[model samples]
Target: MENKNLIQKSIDTVRVLAADAVQKANSGHPGTPMSLAPLGHVLWSQVMHYNPENPDWANRDRFVLSCGHACMLQYSFLHLTGYKITLDDIKNFRQLHSITPGHPEYGMTPGIEVTTGPLGQGFANGVGMGIAQQYMAARYNKKDYSIFDYKIYTICSDGDLMEGVTAEAASLAGHLGLGNLIYFYDSNQITIEGGTDLAFDEDVSKRFESYGWHVQNLPDINDLDALSEAIKNAQQETGKPSLIKVRSHIGYGSPNKENTAEAHGSPLGKDEIRLVKEKFGFDPDKDFDISSEVSNFYLEAGRKSAENEQKWNELYENYKRAYPELATEYENIISGKFSEEWKEKLPVFDDEKPVATRKASGKVLNAIAEYLPQLVGGSADLSPSTNTVLEAFESFSPKNRDGRNFHFGIREHAMGAVLNGMVLSKYLIPYGATFLIFSDYMRPPLRLASIMKIRQIMVFTHDSIGLGEDGTTHQPVEQLIGLRSVPNMTVIRPADANETAHAWHVAIEHTDGPVALALTRQELPVIDQKKFASAENLEKGAYILSDSEGQPDVILMASGSEVQLILKAQEELKKNNISARVVSMPSWNLFDQQNDEYKEKVFPKAIRTRLAVEAGSTIGWMKYTTDGGDVIGIDRFGESAPADELFKEFGFTVENVVKKATALVSGNK
Candidate 1:
């Protein structure tokens, strides 16, 4: 039997290390870490199937601290458990260039599952991981060889549960019956405010129960035995996800701050730390002290985890020998390598017919889905409108985890977070769809995805004011600019059906960061590749669709549906004996990555008179438009009218474009 005193000492070591890290940084939240340390110890040492030496083990249990303000707890565990994280790294917490940041970032730290600071994002991310685990197990696991049975464990706080995204994710998780998922709600009764009762007074356990989750309420956070038993029970209850409502005190051992709001965010002062350390039987005078016994215990745990991975490796070898093709596919997926033939599967659009870019996107998705089995996603209850449904696949539900299509209901916020979670699996490429205007609802996760640099594709249809009749509330006037403002987020607005197909190609290949595809609901005439530049140039981000003879007098550039208007205006300009070049500028982020020479080649410095037309805000056009240039864009909300009528009323006609281009060309602005 394990010595109870040693376990207690190890738990205390975790707590003291977390507190000391915060004390050293003089920033960050300490209370939740102090309270949740026992739980962390129990999971990492006894329960979790993680090899610290190989943090990327495919079958390892995922631990997401949804309340990322308490990142010290994770860092403490990483350091003690013989991960790459060192005591020096913990000492350098929140400092520049340190592995330990203010919050846990996925790739920046060895053991962090996802980057999370915003409340409820990590909670939903865990749900996505659970879904991925379920789907993968169903797809590859034979009856005798259960390859993918890892559980996703998340420790969330009152703040995380209070966020609306968490509610949406919880509802979906319960509905899907993700039994591989287990979340520990740290019911500390305290927020940054005085108490959770100040703003949150609902019965959390009852709420989760209503969502069809297996709810277990434990009144003590320090009860390792109870926590372990609850986890085992959760693992056994394979019909539903589990929520263990752990009633923990904020700053568990602090002499004066326990259970108080003061302990929630700021570090406990040195005097308080000394008292807490003394209370916990540690050297009050020392900082960041870890006992040899606790270190050896965690190291042994890591060794056992490595042994578990070795066994899995052996099984993988056997399975590979038995099932060569499936094993090869699994290896390729985990390594983020796709067959070269998948690129050939990208659809080629017909120029004879007009099609909505969203429709084109749907077609492209299906065409490549056969070759790229890693691609899986759904729309946010707007599949019919967004055209994101995969007609060939069954919906991902409780009954069939092997299905590729996911029905995200109307929860765009949770969908975003869940997509991030799925992508974290390193084998799944997840996308979520909604109207471009509703991107505001999922902005937190979108930003987080970019920050984490995860491979997530967000399909946004009804991209602009052109999504008419729905009026201003549904129209996205500034959404494009808002998306562009996010660093590492590639926002692609295709000009036509063919460009839409190529845009998907770029998104699939561009795995360094997140990509947002803004597609139109209105049908646009497909640009004939024979007459203009080939649609393959879409990879360059901005390309000359149709160029004038020699030095052009004016450059007419636009993106999305407005590119057609620019093309029409080019003909009108030529009728008046003026040379105008039409450029399709799809993605500013991708274009910016191009060298100055390429950018200059597309928009020559000599072409001073330039006009940009788009159906959204004119904020970002100045970068391309020179001194004598101007932008034709809608700055105000759209009216409830037919899309054609609204375009004409808002000066988005060929006549308006011609007039604007004429003025710029003639220096008559």
Candidate 2:
């Protein structure tokens, strides 16, 4: 490896800058940045096409730090290449809200594409970016007019490959033939505890090759020419994703800490950092020093991207004339604006008979699927069961990139992460579905989506123990409570067909955070909107479906399948001279956000005799039930029985609800 050159000097600056920031903060992983600076320099300077002036450029190449503990490497380069991050900002790394946190946060930092910290999440996100780019190109690009021709480049670590989520995403990317993905596996062979051999010794190259990726292994990270050629070869291979495994020392310049776990985490002391600066031919005393030549070089790199963006803008103007309709649609999608015409397409299910909420959801999805070209998704091999298939379009495949529906196979974890990736730009409305029991497999991505506040739709069917005959293992006794507990996650369990339609409408239009539609497997009778409150009230989370004349002795509240039970109980209570109001509480989070006035209107303080019913956990219902109220929910696991028998066994019958309501009212008396 050449020790003295301008390129080497620029790489050294990145390394030193990262270490100095970590040392100043007395925290963060320092070894990864020190070893990976050469690769970062290559991508930001010569390889990738992105404009620091406008990081949100739609056509720009994306860079994801899958090995997110090495976030300082990205931060240092972001400052050097001028992305609104100044030298002082880098100096304030990991401090209180200084834009440089412990890990890369998506909107908190300008150039960051996604929030990454948990290993393999960013890897899956990069695969999603590749999928999104291919679909966008297939739908929007024309001959000699590449509207969306960008690659998703990523740098992952040994730990990333070890995660199960990475395997799921990698297999999908390979099967899709995502040629736009180029991942560099940083093989330092060192984990926090010790060497990779303690637990991992399998041939990763052979494994990735089996997954159908274009594989290349570089003997040394110092061999810059070899790394460049591998990237070039990866770009040329338009049939598969590429992985280049590069072996490098964890702590490159540190004399004692190099190739050791001591360097992976913890900041180098002042003496060690000063020694590194001296080795890189910088002033040993100057902590955050950068040579003027290197600074000018990266600043020039930033300016050149603006020229590229200028050309893209010019191309887009011409494209508008050539294809007016597509250009307009593209503008609308990019701006996060949608026509209200789709709202008209929402179905009215009152005329229909009893039907499963999942079945009704399928109809509502297909009704407006044509209106929004950006609305596309599939299931985790549960499309038939979850009813998430788009009837009008073909499934997206290696051969059919323009297809709207995605066959994400049986990978729930990857599907959730992929949806997060696709929806990050606000241009694509992506969704993924599976049985409610399997949402446990998707917790990481679900939490990440909420943390990022991105719009992702998760359709979870077979909700509650009512999905019977499959036993307790298949039943989701507490999944609803689990999803409801997550912040920024709106969990809606529609009562019937009409509420299901409204739920889909709200999901499609929601821009703040992810929404989970917990649909039932059993058929539920549609509530007549003409006789009761309009089904459109489902958007408000909780609504009065059926009410007593003026004042009520007791209130019956429920969600999803249990709403029908409460409705029946309301009629039964009325027959007994006990006036009970029926409240369809579809979403607790949404109702919680409502003003006190709205909440009081539904669950008034005067009416303390309230009876709540649901087939999931009873933990969260107590807040709404209050001291004078009672709730009927399955706190224990369910048994293998028919849906009707299970409901009877679990005390979800209308007779049981009537008994509970009468008892609550009598107890208040």
Candidate 3:
């Protein structure tokens, strides 16, 4: 607090850089970065544990800009603090191919923890980081050598809080008692519509407190001492997550637009910028300029982080000597490596007895859980429904940090974000589960998961109208198609218990992106062994389950609960003296990767009469359904009725499927 002028100058430097970038780009949010300058200064300089020179340092504390539109704040800080983001990159904000885009994307930008821009996602991603922290600490840290004691700090805005996803994640963070997670709420009281009071007047601090968070309020926006003290107090509270509400103006330095809505998005004119600089006692003409001394302040901060990392390295050496096996496991977890035996342990299902994919998923989870000790996750109050909870595994709770099962209450949005945080930790295979229909509530974070390409599992059960009396609200009609549309996402809808088991196996094997396994709530009859498709074929995306006796009439393709209908259709076609082939296409993305030879062999390049059957949308089935072929799919939303009634009414039946297949084969007149 002694070098108050220098500290204030450094903070003001961030504000100017933000304003300059927004003004130069002619588009971008200047309000947040300008207003929250002091808060960012305190967190980055005095609080965060990170090395700007080594942004990928494993044990460093993570800082997520959840309100990513305020990315100028982060880009400016990274440049001044010695990261790879150059001032030129700041000048090129919102331009094509630039690291600084409209939103903070992972892999594209250095020091960005998660690809955040869809409001509320960064906060949820922070929750995931907190989960990883606890799991790693419980598994790796020794009595004296606590190597992974790092916090995940998030800076969010009113829009972030207004979004429902953050509310769900905040509740889960509290439930887990993640003391290492700290959030700095930019209480700027303004929204695009003018003031937050016009739309959002609920007590945010009280809401977080209700979730058992340690809440603090800083009265003065520019008071670094007060902000620092509140942060320290929050850090000291051990059993709860923390939220520090820092009151700030939308544009803190600008003389006229400081607290106005105009500062929220539009850049202040050059004249106004000059006036703001004069107020801060800065040269009115200079742009993106900071004194070397002010920049060096953060360099010293970076050097301290490197020294801290070196100290941790020495302690870890001692830890390895004390617990060799555990240390090895810890290293593998951090490096994103699973045991070789984990691959071998994947269950193989067959068309033998009746089995629901959800039930099979439960069995597969237990088997894989046996081999991978670091696999941790739970359901969004749908453990029984999703069949994601493994038996004999400890539940992850405030009292039991070593447990694996996480009860995310009924908050689906939070579950997805928290899992992202856990995956971001790079030490645990985190998964979340819920009914497939509820995916709508979780899509924002789920989209971020695909963008981040983190290895997280989404065990979505109650797929389609097959979920029974749970009704239309619970049924997932468009969810499958919605998930499939996302690039880099693998959407797997298993037909039976065996396929469900195989889907889980493939999901874990996928290290590049997120996997959504849609399981059935109703029990499905396992296919006959000879008639069943190879689980290995799932990796190929699509394969022939029952082929035509010759280069014959029609090809029937389906997935998930509807694959059974395809089989029934095939049987009826055989009875009618027609030879039809059946294909179980569990994952289109995986199948699309197969060689053309394999694809042609299954669908036959010459056979043009095709019929695609699935309980969901037929939008993307045109590739398989040739010019004359038909698609037997639900084209509209489902109704609130018994699962059986919905399925019949919606035409998801063997009768309709067979009729369509027969017509396609005959080139229906």
Candidate 4:
């Protein structure tokens, strides 16, 4: 009991802080934090190694709160430890402009590893972090150097385990033997709606074991010794990820709310808080209470952890001498820069023969894989179809951690989250792929990546009805606009091989957000750089591919496969003695970034009779197509037929485009 008083007091402080913060905010989940306080104290104050002074220390362990609603648990510990967060910040929980938002956000909060509030997202994100640790260890760790040995620790809830993404990530983690990942299931048997018995009841430990994880079930979370031992044992298992299931009361120490849903979401009343504070041996009148003893204990814990980084820094100096090149490369990646010469390795497509943009993307990946070793990825079991394979690399697996190609199976949502987690490492520029139709499954991570402002690539292929024979269910008629709908998300629909190459270049160079390459399965005619504007104009988003002799009567604009149709239609319009300018509008987001002068030059003020033809939804096209202009796009779902047939049926043809241009030119639109 010598150490029990200080540790228990520290855990009790976490509980009271949760209680006080939620009571002040008048909203937010309180019970999960109260219940998991012991786990939080053990993990943050004892088990996890990190210099609170440097939350971003290269080799510091990562902590992901998968049960992000229990963010008070994270926030309380963050404050007590020597992180940037303060008690005042905790008091302002869920308030406007506060770092302590309802859910823990990565960049917003000092200690938060990833922005996680979406259930199960953090669970998958931790798996991605595990993959990153494994990859970095394989890439940088020398025989004696032990660099990149940091582990990923996460706390998930029953709700997290119930989410499908969690299952997908768990299975992949087990398959790859991510022994560095340790997850704690705060099995308080409570959720916001009601008791988990109302919906969820399954053998969670058995399930994780089936997924090949090392499983340990602790009967009580209050038994701090057992929690520490389980974590230690988890670290000892070096071949599989581990899960510790802790049984605990929801609002531990609450007179009436413990083990009840009432405490799970809403704040406990003043009387209840007072009662709990008294029970924990605190001044019953005080709110947001942190006793002197508890504060000193955690402060000392934080100070002691700084030694981990100091030791790692020394080892790093030795590592540099032993592995000079690898050391420089590691430094470059963590600083988020890479050899600019990789740009030269980007293959150029000069052939006039039609080539699928997806195939072009594959060529780009293969051409630069050796030069850009950090550019690692594979498709969601659709590598052959999505063409996301790095041909020269072996699959990343249990035996081969150095492999660049990751077979993320058919789990699209988990793959997106995993990629998010992997990119969290300053070392890997990861990407994932699937059909555009399947992106619906991966929207959470896609949005999270943008929110965190993480730079990664997503190859979304079979972009439109042109994916033929896939039927309406497989074809993505609205996905283009859907992705564009996400703020800060850059969606690039490359018209052909050359444009696709530039899209990848833009994706790598642009560092602010995630870039989705919406590529075509059907072959598109290569736009010759000599005959028209350069494909390099793709960086500008929308460019005048081919122009009219003077101020054209009608302007023709399109993206992806339809660009060829508009080019042909421009000629058709010219044959009819009607002047028309053809514009290749590949990326709306990029084009928006261009100056007004450039936008006006591309869409001249005199050109109101413009026609925008695309194979997908016409939702966001009106910005380019003036009031007098029209858009030829699929307002309905696609059909099961040949790509050519679907294009024709949907009015995505040269004949139809010419007709629309004639009508607009004739003032009949």
Candidate 5:
């Protein structure tokens, strides 16, 4: 039926191009790409429905290279299939500012589905994409009009399967019955260290099957018909995700390193590459050689994909006329536009009642969820503790694909990666919640989300030592600073119920990067907005909440629950002829973005006597405190006690703040 000779020539083109790119760069893994070339050819030519001309087509199948070290494989496919990736781009692989980086970056490359370098992250991200696909299809698809049916395909390695995050994501994918997910496990049985037998020896096929996946094992990597048939079988089974364990060699044609660990990470020598090219029936002297016939074949495949996209565009037009409202909503979501009035839906909190910031976050989330249909997320089995559950929405499970709330079980690591995947789908505003301390477990995905600059909201409750009785292990002493250290991450610690509501507003509106909301488990007294500055000033990042007469003798600054103590200390200072100003610094990242005039206005260079208070690490307070000021924060781990007692023990009390401010003012004078 198909031209077997042409297909094999195309596969060799992929292999040769990838091996040449890695050999030129001298800094990449070439084995996986060489081994997976046939599979890549089959996917691009026969399976995937992607228009190289319009790589961002909404309904096109998503491909993620989970073994991102083998990114040359994806780069070769992109170049061959005419996705705007030029030959020069492949030649400059891993060079500075090149589109072909060591790993696949979402926005940098046209066809890259997600930014993936860390082993298990892309695997989990594929799960998130599967969830998003199911959600969109369930909500938008009608009878005889399947508008949103796209499969997510990931090529994963042994390292990806061995990671715990992948295990977590695989379990959840099975539980959700994400039939749209079809992953290829490259069973090369070689890690960076040696053979996988040195460490990993479990029956991976049985493992995925036990997790409720449709499992298939292929013994040959070069069998294009078998690979195509397996993919078709995977697509037919519409009740569970499919895992095809492909037994591939590390370096398929290399003479000396075909199945060796040496081929896993390093580039093959020029001589060895020539030998491999010779084995594949190519001229040994040729480098980066691509047959003209293979090039024409892939270009023809791209033309067919473009036709498929044209058909989808026609269907979308008719669907738009039939259901104008739903179509409008869909258009808005795909364009990443939210209603201007969505801000009006934020709830106003009453200052009379004390409320945990987490609880207030829940109310704000539910209130805004009504206006924002794109908002979708869940907690890491801490919905009750983190207060992230959307009360009106049903849980997202195998039975209900349209549900907004997801139960990620106890998988914090997978939750982070999945959130990135959902956001990468370009329609959903995804959020995930867990304790602030456990953010360490999810830092890889969180960092990747920042690097990718996707719209992800990370809600972290039990923020500090104030979350006592669970002791040091549960408390987050340095998590705030750690989150702040990331390049594009916005870490917001809300002072009260009002600020908590505003933080969510900022998170939803701030589309440039990920936002981390650090909330408290203990009830924090809401600042009376009428008496103090309006909570709307929170957009300024740091604002003068309560100022004294004249230039003020000292500035008392804090965030989260400690702001209440600073407010109380201001009253005590006023009684003792001390004019102290209280400043609520909710977000350092936001504050840094402000102009120097605004930053100086909030901190005020005239008032050098400043005292900062927080119930967490004191490392990053010096920037705000300056030379004449000091920070009063916990530098050590917390102890097992009541929250009130812990606050006092950690010197996070009104008395401690007053004493520190008094001494700073005296010394400054």
Candidate 6:
């Protein structure tokens, strides 16, 4: 067994590096890294199964620092353990272009698993990573070779524990029985303002216990053996996640700022630095010191990691020989390749069999899920209503990781953050669903996913006033526009079932960033093939569903349920001896991606009389509607009545849309 004295020395090594780095940079949170040093050392050196040499190894353990303010502690460990992080990187901490930043970002740093700093995001993400591991192990792991057997470990603080998202994720983790998920709570009893008692005084261990987690308390922060034993106990508990509350003083050994909020952030002054260095038995005059013995100790961990990788490779070779087809799929998933057969499997919609885009979306998801086994997701208590659940797949429960469905309950915010973590794991295609109105609750994670360019899916249903009876609270009036505003985020509001299927088709194939599918609740009439074009044109953003004889005087543009309204208006215009064109604009972002020539061809400038209508906010319609164009849309919150009444009260009738179109045509004439 590693001696307690040796572990304490290692922890001191981590603490001193953090203190020196913060002191040198004249910035950063010193208290967390200083206090959590012993716990981090215990977990990384003794319990965690990560390979510092190959941070991208598929089956290696995942580590997330939920308390991202304490990034220096992670950087110090990475530097000492011989990961890509260097002492120089730590010196340049929080610099403009340096790898070491204020927070731990997934792709930016070598060992960071998820981009964290947003309070409970890292903890929520850890829950997601645990879920991904369970699904991967269930789907691919053979009896002899434990290919996907890995744990997700995270170190969080009072801020992370206090966030509502953390509570939601913890509940879900317990319900799923993610035994491999272990979290180390740094119980320093200090926050930025002062003690946690100021704003957060809840008993964290009891709260986690309520969430069905096995809670353990380590009275001594310096007790490495006890910490390891607690982890062992957690690993042995096959039906519950574990939370270890480590009681420790913030900035332990620091003479002046120990246990004070002053140590939470900001660099210790040069004088205080000298005192800490003297206490750690380091040269007060020198900075960034790593004893030769300490450096050599970490090199052993690197060598052991390489050897473990080699063993896994040999096992995989034998497994490949035994199961060739499964091996090919595994390699493809790891390599981020999808068979063309998967695309061929995507359902094609005919205009004659008009279906609600949400229904089509569900079909597309089911088809893609059949080929891409890594695809795993759930709705925020709206699985059946959102049409996001896979029919044949089982629910992800405490006892079984093989289940495909995720029951997120009512926690939209946590579900979103958890999805981000799963995507960061690189083993599962994570997605979340809820009513479009509830998107406001989950916007933070959604924005973070966009900023990180993570390929996660968000299914938003009950898109507009068409949701009915649920009132303005349930119906989303501005959400579509709000979601569409996010850079690199593809928002698809499918018109009919075929378009919805195509939207999912594009969503799954897109590997760059996040994709959100906005779906409707009501059934839509299927456009006749003889009268309307195929739904494949939906990829163009705006496609002419029905056209006039020649150079139409007016054009009608709409999306989702409103597309049928424009079509009805077009028929009425034709009967009145007026030439009108109907366009279905399913996704404005995808359409903007289309070539300029294609855009102009779809919306001819010659037809200056354009009318756009939808049952949502009008803020986004200015782009489609030109100077002479008119938009018939809801400008304010909807009413608490039936969807049909709301639509009528909101003036979402074909007559109103036709009136706008007729006025534009008359002006053109």
lDDT of 3 at 477: 77
Which pairs clash inside model 4?
A: none
| TM per prediction | 0.98, 0.98, 0.96, 0.99, 0.98, 0.94
Worst 10 residues of 4 by lDDT: 1-10
How well does model 1 score by local distance difference test?
0.91
Q: Scored by CA lDDT, what does every candidate get? A: 0.91, 0.92, 0.84, 0.90, 0.91, 0.84
In TM-score terms, candidate 3 sits at: 0.96
Q: Write the per-residue lDDT of candidate 2 for residues 1-669, one digit (tens) a residue.
A: 233488899999988998899999999999999999989988888788889989998889999999899999999888889899988899899999799999999889999999999999999999989989998899889998998889999999999999999999999999999999999999999999989999999999999999999999998998888888999999999999999999999989998788999899988888899889889898988888888888988998888866788999999898999999999998898786888878899989756788999999999999999999999999999999999999999989999998999988999999999899998755889999999999999999999999999999999999988888999999999999999999999999999999999999889888778999999899988888889899889999999999999799998899999998988888898999999899999999889989999999999988888889999999989898889998999999999999989999999999999998898888888
lDDT string, candidate 1, 1-669, tens digits: 268988998888888888888889999888989899889988888889999889999999999999999999999888888899989999999999999999999899999999999999999999999999988998889867888999999999999999999999999999999999889999999988799899899999999999999999999988888999999999999999999999998898999999999998898999999999999999988998888888898888888877889999998888888878988999998887889887888888764589999999999998888888888999899988888878888889999998999998999999999999999889898888999999999899999999988889999999988888999999999999999999999999999999999999989888888999999999989888888998888888899999999789899999999999999999998999989999999998988899999988999987789999999999989999977799999899899998999999999999999998888777743
Question: For this target, which candidate reaches the highest lDDT against the unseen true structure?
Answer: 2
Question: Which of 2 and 3 is the better model by TM-score?
Answer: 2
C-alpha displacement of 124 in model 4, angstroms? 0.3
Q: Model 3: runs farther than 4 Å from truth?
A: 1-3, 350-352, 531-533, 639-649
lDDT of 3 by residue, 553-660 (tens): 888888987888888888888898878888889999888878889987887778888888888877888888879788888777777777778789888888887787
- Candidate 4 on 1-669: residue-level lDDT in tens? 357777777788889889999999999988989999888888877888888789999889999998888999998888888899988899899999999999989889898999998999999999988998888889888898898899999999999999999999999999999999999998988887888998999999999999999999999998988999999999999999999999989999899999999998999999999999999899988788787788888989998988999999999999899899999988887776778788888887776588899999999889888888788998899999999888888989999999999999999999999999998886788999999999999999999999988887999999999889979999998889999988889999988899999999999777788999999998878888789898999999999999988878888899998899988998888899998898999999999999999999999887788889988889989988979889999899888999888878888878888887887788743
lDDT of 6 by residue, 198-270 (tens): 9888888899999899999999887777988998998898678999999989888899999999998888888
- Is 2 or 6 the stronger prediction by lDDT? 2
For model 1, which pairs clash?
none
Off by over 4 Å in 6: 1-9, 351-354, 574-578, 603-609, 665-669
Segments in model 5 whose C-alpha atoms lie over 4 Å from true places: none
Position 222, candidate 1: lDDT: 86
